[model samples]
Structure formats: structure tokens, C-alpha cells
Target: MTNSTAKEEILGRIRNAQKIAFSGKDLASSAGVVTGTPGEHFAVPRDYERTSDMPREEVISLADERIADYKADVRRCSAEPAEINEAVKKAVADAGAKIVGIPSGLDKAWVSGLDEGKGEIRVDEGLGVRDLDALDAIVTSSAVTCAETGTIFLDGSPACGRRALTLVPDVHICVVPADSVVYGIPESISRLRDADPTVPITMISGPSATSDIELNRVEGVHGPRTLMVIIAG
Candidate 1:
């Protein structure tokens, strides 16, 4: 079963145990609610809010703050093609990237300002891990983002490219459309319901990092060390 399913089952047991104690009911012995087989399924109530009514501006603002909290650089730009391109160009330059990967399906306008003079814009054509690792950075548009969690979801769309394209790169520059930003994970998942499940779904909260038992922090242990988020609204 999925992790979510396991969690709900465990919580159901806890709640049932609490109810039995509070109400002086012997349901556990009479109904065997807690003695079910390992794979027995328990229905879980999913009545929690799944969508947000927050304004678009607030959603984007909260995303910016949350993403920045992870120590990733966040920048906001107009949704216009020109402005996005300029913001992307500036970010590329700031990162001092000389070899940049532009995934397939990404809008040409986003990289219109980037040329050979600034860096090599390598178009992703099912590149392997080694090929991506050689690049200085990569730029791609995200499928959707959860503002509350600062999580960006890259469905294997042409625009987002293959999951490997972002994973192996040293730096990732993800362009997020403001309207594509949702308030929470449920809404974000709802946005991708129509996509093919076989296609990979990459959930990136921040640049990959971890701390040792000593609590010494390190970055880039698993994936890109630097993450630059460009929010285009």
C-alpha cells in the first residue's frame, strides 16, 4: 500500500482506541477493529480542505517566503514573455553559468535573451545523467507549484523535460507561472490529474541537502546544490 494509506490506517487505530476509552465501549474486543489483518483496508475520511480561496497575489507571496526559507533564491517577474526572458537572463548571469540546459517544451521566449555569447543553451533531447552533470545549469518551466509547501512539481511534460534532466544538473532554475501556483498539495495534485501517470512526477521543495548526526548541514548531496526560482505572474 502507499505511504498515505498506511498513515490513515494507523491514525484510524489511534482514534478508535481513544473513542473506546472515552466512551467506555468494548468495541475493540467485540468488533476487532484493532486486530485486523495487516493488509485490511480502513476507510479514511478525507474531508479536509483540498482547495484554496486565497488571492493569487497572496499565494505567490507565500510561495516566495517559503521557498526563500529553504535558502534558495527566489525572484518575481511579470508574466509577459519579455519580462520573463529578462529575469531568466539576469538569473543565469548571476549564477555565472556558462552551459545551460533548456528542456524541450519550454517557451522559447524564456531564453530569447540567452545566446552563445552569454552561454551555451543546450536543448534537452533525452540527455543522460552524465550529459546533464556536465552542464553548468538548467532552466525549465514547472507544471505546478504548491505555495503552502514551497514544492514545485515537474510532471514529465515537454516543458518540464525528463526527471533526470533536473536531477543531475548542478543548478536548477525553475520558472513558475503565478497562476499555476496553488495553495496546497491537494490542489497541486488535482492540477495534474489529467497527465499520464507513467510520466514521472518530481516534487522539489528546495535544493537537495542533508545534515549529519552531528547536525552539520551540507547541500547538493542528492541533487542540484543551487536552486533559483523565477516566479512569473
Candidate 2:
């Protein structure tokens, strides 16, 4: 049979076997929602759930512990450099890399320092979509981080730029301040409740890694192969 005819025959059989399990009324009632229509009630039901139980004091403590632990762990692994400049320099050198700094009016001195006097760096102030192949590494500050999970939160604002830069490159170096770090996911979500809904945010923990059927873990499955974090003093 011709391609169109073959496709039609397959589609006909598939449609005969297909089933839609829910009616609009059934779905809406099951969800405890009442509205003009099922679609209209989507937001209503969600707003009725219990508020988050993340305590402010507990969140603060959790953040402190996690940040401390991450710092300590990095130190134990011989993974972090002594200073921010040193850490940046080492990470770049370790990867034989170039720099991609997010635009936050980074001091010329600070940006120049990352080059380690090599003088071959690009300042992405326009914050346009960057080419992945041309970039070796990207570095920027995170809005906040969750210490409980070791996850970095990147709100795509003027300081952090887009999520693509973080995902596309082989290596990403995130700089986070101690004060901005939070304790856990619960705290993080609560803190973001009033945030500008327009911007996209990303939460990252460690290098992108996944496991196989044999439980063999592999890194960089969907994101950067390496994740290097610098906690600015």
C-alpha cells in the first residue's frame, strides 16, 4: 500500500482500541471542584490544599547545616579552592576552559581575574541564547540554594540569565552566597510563593547523573557532566 493508505489503516485500528477514561463532570467531582466547567476549576482545587508547614526558623537552620555540609564535603574531597578567585581559576584550568559570565554588572576586576590573565573571555551582557559548541563552561550566581538537597536554584533574571546556558555547557560553575542558601525543598518552595510568575527557574543538584538497570550510575545524562559550586564569602 502507499504511505498515506498504510498510515490510515494503522490509525483506524489504533483509534478503535483507544479509550478516554474520564468525563468532564466525573473528573471535576472526583477532584472536589465545582465550577462552570472542568477546565475552569483547575486552579480552584489547587488553592484549597493545606498551606506549607515549612517553619522560618527551621528553614534557616536547615539552610545553614546544608551549606556547611556542602562546604565541608568539598573541602574533604580536595575539591574546592581556598578563595573565590582561586576556585574560579582552578575550575577553568581544570577543564582547559573559557568563561561565560552572566550579566550582573560583575566588577571588571572580578571578571578579569577569572581569565587568570589569559585575556580570552566573553561577557554575555546582552544575555542572548549562547552557542553550546563554542562554549567550554558557564559561570554565574544562583538566586538561592537548598542545602538539604544540595540543589542550586537559578531564577532567570538579570543576574542568572537563561537556564539554557547552564544546561548546554559541559561544565557549570555556580556561585551562591551563604545568606541566600536555604535548608530544604519545602522552605525553598515557600520562599518562592510570591516570586514573579513570569520568569523560569531551575533547581539543580550535583552533576547530571542517572542509573541503569544494573544500578550502575552514570554522570551527565541530561545536563552538564560536571557541577562545580563556589560559595562566596
Candidate 3:
């Protein structure tokens, strides 16, 4: 049979089944095909679990492991604000960051240890794309992270500035709370949906890397080249 004949036969079978299921009518006897109503709705079964069965601690550990496997730096620290500050400071210092950009509403304590005289800290207040591109690094807090995918979600919250800030910078230092690390994408989306549905969300899996036709791996082609995740309890 020709390709067009085979295609028509498959489509005819699908239309016949759908007509039988939805309208209880046999389209085989009809001269013309039956079409579905534009606004018709089908009840889809959502029986799958929203998250994995891993424990909370295991989820966090898995997130760290997966993120590290992507060549992103992971810093585990205590729940204390002071400890988070120290970790952030060290990350910036290790990067030799001279100009750090942050969202206006980011917690000051995260980078409180940085010396202004030695390094410049710019709070983002509608900074142009060019300004963000010149910065050495940008630090922000993540809304949620998926352990299975090693994905971080930023919902343009006070902690997460506009998407441009994270995308334009060479390096990004994301501070993810232990509690925000979930087992999978469904759990992450559920948590974010409860928070706010209108806010823009940006998901980051790892440093921006792409392989060309030659399979040459190149980093930082689209987004930040370095991703430093601080998993603070």
C-alpha cells in the first residue's frame, strides 16, 4: 500500500474508536466522519504519585549528588544564617568575584561577609542587560529544586530577580534551602503552584552547555558557565 493510503486507514480507525467512545455512534456506517465538539472535555486519570518515595534527607542528598554530577559546585552548610553567610562568602572568594550582583530583596546575610571595598555588590533595580553581563557573579535564592532532575526553580520572587539577571551573568550562586528540595518535578510544581501561579518561573538544570555536530562540549553558550549551589538547611 502507498504511504497516503496507510495513513488514511490509521486515522480512520482512530476516528472510529473516538466516535464510539464519545458519541456511542458507529462512524463506519456514516458517509462522513464525526468530529468532536470544540469544548468537549475528557476526564484523564491522574493516579501517579506526585513525588518519589525517597525520604526528605535522601531527596536533599540526591539533589546534591545530581547537581554535582552536572559540574556545578555544591556547598552543604548548617541551617544557621551565619553558616550560610560563610559559605556564600567562600564561594564568591573562590571565584575571585570582584562584582557581585544580587536581587534587591535577597537576604543581606547571604553576602554580608563580603567586603565592599574589595568587591562590589550591586543590588539589581532594573539593571540593563549590559550591566548584568559585566558582573562577575549573581547570587539568588531558589524557590524549589527537584532531586531527580537536579533542577532549580526561580519564580521571580524577591530572592530571584528577573530571569535576565541569572541568564546574563557568567556565574550564578543559588542558595537552596534544604526544605525546598523535593523528590521530583511534580512535587516542585505543586509547591510552586501553591505559592503563586502568575509569577514567572525559570528552571535551571546545570551550567549552560551544548554539544555541536562534532560532539565538542562547550559551556556558557546560553547561560551562566558556573553554577554554585549552596544547600543550606
Candidate 4:
């Protein structure tokens, strides 16, 4: 009849309904609503294909196309180390990079072609944030790339380096092996897990860009403004 009484009635009804719904068992009991045993394994349906059936060459081509569509530069080079070095050299030269940061374990040969007078190469072992920002660009290797999404995955491997190295630099030149390009996200994840499940993964769709309320697109808000991918096959 009164507000207090009505509230009490509603609460009582809710309790009764819960008891009936739970078949008179305690609501907190695991058996009441949750019945799965601890540590029990259940078979999950994996009807989807782990990866697309496209051939390796086709996958790489699709990845290159998608990467270009994202407005990122894509360069193709022979799989040979020397050619890769030349490609890296050209990418840096085109960016007009005076100072470049590279991961500690990255192949020194990649930057071997860079002339000391034109550009300085700094290996990032444990560089400070400002140190990385001062560099003209950062060069690293990708663990895997997804052709479907035009995404690159970095798992902090020796070649990938720390996350900050990529975030602070204005230009990022990622060297991706053609074989590392996968058909889709599922295949990418599978490959990454097989590589190192515990390592952190960073996925880049494109150079960092954001749209404001008026739909004005601005680039390089949080990460590199320019992304160049060298697909070495």
C-alpha cells in the first residue's frame, strides 16, 4: 500500500522467483546456475579454416596490395640479404632520414648500405624515450602480416624491438619477409602463438591517424605518421 511496503513486496517476489528458478538451491551455490566442473575441458567447434587456401605468392601479393591501399608504401625486393639491404637503404634515403633507430638484434646488414655521411644508424638496446624521438625514423622487422586486414604484427622479437621504438618515431620502415605474410587474422594468431605465446604483440593497420568531430583526418597523433613496408620475397 505505501512506498516502503511496495518495495518490500517487490523484493519478496524477486527472492521467491529466484528460488524457484534455481530449483530451491542456494543462489550462491555453483550447482544452482554454474554446473561446469573446475578444470574440465570441453570440445569447442573449430569449423573455420585456420588460414585461407591461397598460395604463398598470392598471399604476399594480396598483402602488398592491401598495404598499399592503407596508404602505406610497399616495396618489393628479392629475398636475398643484399637486395634487402639495398631496399632498406633506399627507403631511408627516400624518407630523408638523417638519423635512424634500429633494434639491437636487427641484422646490421639491413642498414649496411646507408652512407654514414647521409644518415646515422643508432642501434636501440635501451634507448630513452627522448633518444628515440630524436631519431628521424625507426626500422624494424615484422613477425607476421595479415593480408586480409593489411595488418602487421610485432611480437617484440629481437628484430621487432621494444614497442616504444616504433611509437615515438615519425617514420617506420618495417621489413617483412614474404613468407611471413598470412591469409588472415586466424593464421596470424596461430603463427604468432607458435613463435612465442608469452611475448606481447602489436598490430598496425596503418600509420597512426585520427578523425575529429568535423571528420578532419589528422595523422601521427599517437604513433608514426609514415609507414613503409618492404616485402622481401
Candidate 3 Cα errors over 4 Å, as ranges: 1-41, 194-198
Error of 1 at 218 (Å): 0.7
Off by over 4 Å in 4: 1-39, 194-198
lDDT tens per residue, model 1, 1-233: 99999999999999988987899876766865555556888776689999878888899999999999898999999999999999999999998998999887999989985875756888999787788888999999998999899999999898998888888988999999998999998899999997779997999989999999999999999899999999998
- Candidate 3 has its poorest 10 consecutive residues by lDDT at 28-37
Question: Which pairs clash (backbone N, Cα, C closer than 3 Å) in model 2?
Answer: 62-183, 63-182, 63-183
lDDT of 2 by residue, 179-198 (tens): 66666566667766655689
Judged by TM-score relative to the true structure, which candidate is superior, 1 or 3?
3
Question: What TM-score number comes out for model 2?
Answer: 0.61
lDDT of each: 0.90, 0.62, 0.89, 0.89
TM-score of each: 0.81, 0.61, 0.83, 0.83
Model 2, residue 14: what's the lDDT? 72
C-alpha RMSD in Å of predicted model 1 compared with the true structure: 7.8
Q: Write the per-residue lDDT of candidate 3 for residues 1-233, one digit (tens) a residue.
A: 99999999999999888878797665544846545555997555578888677888888899999999899999899878899999998999988899999999899988895756788899999999789888999999999999998999999988888889999999999999998899877789888875556767899988999999999999999999999999999
Higher-scoring candidate on lDDT, 2 or 4: 4
RMSD of 4: 5.7
Most lDDT-accurate candidate: 1
Off by over 4 Å in 2: 1-83, 99-101, 104-109, 125-130, 193-195
